[model samples]
Target: MAFSSPELNFHKNIGFLAFLPLKTKTSISLISGKVVALEILYRMVYNSLTAFGGQHHERIRYEQSLADAKKAGLRKGLYLGISQAFVNISLYGAVALIFWYGPYLARIECWNYDAGVVMIIFTSCLFATNSISMFIPYIVAFIDAAVAGAKVFAVIDRKSPIDYTNHTNNQPHVVRGDIELRNVTFNYPARKEKKPVNYLLFSFYIIHLESL
Candidate 1:
């Protein structure tokens, strides 16, 4: 349930952090599913509030999520919500009916029951369940946030299979709109890259070679 600063970031291959724990859905489901969702949402809002934040980026994220949702239409979430509500209402209604009618039915010959006792016992559970309902959404929210955070964190945690090997030179390299790739093979990452492009925007120095 506790993640140190470095544990939050698994990008670097650290040594002796054996206590860091291996990646598992257990903790994420147990803790993050309840609390980390809120953390993710709040962090998202905070990030958006930062100076260079842009709504367009968030919108893009949302749209992509929608697209993915559409693609993975196997799951029915709205249906699940409706079903949950109905089940809760039905269960509560049945309990209420039992407590209400149990007294009348008890008066029947040899039908012995304590309606008051049942009501008191169930009432406590009802109240407790109701109280828990208040936190359920927050838990789900945290779960959602954790998923979002995890996606980003997972991306950040990725490693480049193709190292900057075959550098061809030891000095810093630069690209000034002019370079050549003939029979020379280069495999660009269409997706799966750990660091953000912005990080690379200014990292290089200069290159005598130019790209057409």
Candidate 2:
């Protein structure tokens, strides 16, 4: 019902990201976060193309993404328009059929039809059609909500690879251990060309005594 500024900002950002292509969103997220830092290094934080590396490539990628999004939107719009049109035609056609058939049925002697019965049927049909038409416009909104809900539940139901539970073999009343690491060589994926860290070694002994 109500959201704080930070939460509102996050939702707004997520909404923006939802409209963009996945690759474009990922690239923008990855690069935009460091834009300030890069700019700061060059003594400019705003409107500095030099600090934003790979400008030409990024521009091309973003333009492609934009075009893709626009095309997708247009396609979906066409589908929605067609669906709405069909629904309107069917609904109004049903109404029109009742309008034409009700009076005809009232004139038939064998069917025992009357003016009151015809009017009731016509009014009921009209009311039902109006109600459905009022609700038809919301179908698209409902579909969007369902899609978003599915994505949220997918993330919620996913299992994490990391285990948070701790299973220590030490006795309940006493704990003692020595941990050691040696010859660890690694480098960040972003800076792999720099150098791999080597000669890293460390050891620590933990000892503790307590009541159960």
Q: Which prediction has the highest TM-score against the true structure?
A: 2
Per-candidate TM-scores read 0.33, 0.52
Candidate 2 per-residue lDDT, tens place, 104-202, comes to 887776377778887787677666655655544455565555555765799899987654464553335654566667987787533444445776677
Superposed by TM-score, candidate 2 places the C-alpha of residue 119 at a distance from the truth, in angstroms, of: 2.3
Model 1: per-residue Cα lDDT over 70-141, one tens digit each:
432323344335434643654466457656665666566334556665666567656654553344223334
The lDDT per prediction is 0.43, 0.54
Q: Which stretches of candidate 2 lie over 4 Å from their true place?
A: 1-47, 50-58, 160-212
